[model samples]
Target: MIPASDQDLEQVQAQFQALVMPHLDRLLGFASRRTRSVAEAEDAVQEACVRAWLGFAGLRDPAKVRPWLYCILRAVLADNCERDGRRQRLVSITRLEDEHEALVGGDDDAVLVEVEGRLTGEVIRAALADIPEDFATAVEMHDIDGFKYQEIADILGIPIGTVMSRISRGRRLLAGAVASNQRAWLRDDGKGERQAEARRAARAGGFDGGVTS
Candidate 1:
């Protein structure tokens, strides 16, 4: 595409900031759940942002901005996955330790709470990564991002029934993965202790939907 005029560039940037910037965290979360690494997720979101800025003029309906951005993000992810030989890479949970540390920014107890929450998120993300791409995307968009079925279908360019099917299957697989992981942890004394501690911390903070004792 030709470079935008100075005036056009300014207008596009303004619209993008207004419509797309607000969804950056959600986009990053969505990408993170799909990607193997934080760097890859960030790359996908960055590419999507640039594409959105360039194509901002074509997006006339403000109401469709969120899905439009998602479309761009999805495409970027697909391209990256294809180029990487379709390998579903696992994220290193250790990296999350740093994020948890930054998030807690407090004494020991607060640090423990953040670690529990971070591990819960990591477990889910890892499970999602192991599922089929379509199924994982359906589950993440509908369940994690809180999009309606019809909205998911539209974003994915599939029928609503297919979206529902993918989500149901994906959720089943996710639950099995979580349960299996918890059982494995329980089998080992050291890991089991860590798992119990994390759950206790999560409970103290009133967090829900993690490995239950």
Candidate 2:
């Protein structure tokens, strides 16, 4: 294929930045939650953005920017997994059942109320980390990143029903993880107090709903 002129490349870069740059933090958060290491997440984001930039001239709709970038990121993640031989360890959807079922009992909506009341960015990250990767991906894309179900389905390359199921199951898992006092991750000395302060600050900064668990 013939390369675009420098002027065309410049316009593509400008448009790509305008649309994609705004979502970079969220995308990084997405990658960070999925990957085991910070370096891996950063590498995934870098590769995905490079691929995005290379294909920017073909992107026709500004509104589709977020999903397009996510699609690229997912591909990068899959590639990374394959390269690292982690793909063989991927558990099927059926394996999520036990964890899904563990989310039962105890006043979920009440737990959700407590979670929302004291939600901080750190707490959200922790909760996301506690869930299955697939479920967390769906939840973060739909709830945290504010993508529609259809967009999430497109980005995840799954049926819309599957996306909805994942979001529902993922939200339950997040709520359980956040509300449980027995969680080992929440046991750090005085960390809960710090997280509470962060929550208040987040509210003051207009993060009202706070992850919609």
User: Best candidate, lDDT-wise?
Assistant: 2
Clashing pairs in model 2?
Answer: none
In model 1, how large is the Cα lDDT of residue 121? Answer: 51
Report the C-alpha lDDT of model 2 over 1-213, residue by residue, as the tens digit: 545787777786787788988988888887765666567689899999999988887788888888899899989978876676552222223333444444444456564455466556767766554455678788888888889999988888889999999999887676665655324334557565455444433322334332232
Candidate 2, backbone clash total: 0
lDDT (Cα) of model 1: 0.66
Query: For this target, which candidate reaches the highest TM-score against the unseen true structure?
Result: 2
Q: What is the lDDT of candidate 2?
A: 0.68
Off by over 4 Å in 1: 1-9, 88-120, 184-213
Q: Report the C-alpha lDDT of model 1 over 1-213, residue by residue, as the tens digit.
A: 655697787786676798998899999988766665578779999999999888887998988888899999989978876776554433233333333344446465553453344345545665554344566688888877888999899999999999999888666655544444544433435564455345433322334342211
What local lDDT does model 1 show for residue 33? 62
How do all models score by TM-score? 0.65, 0.71
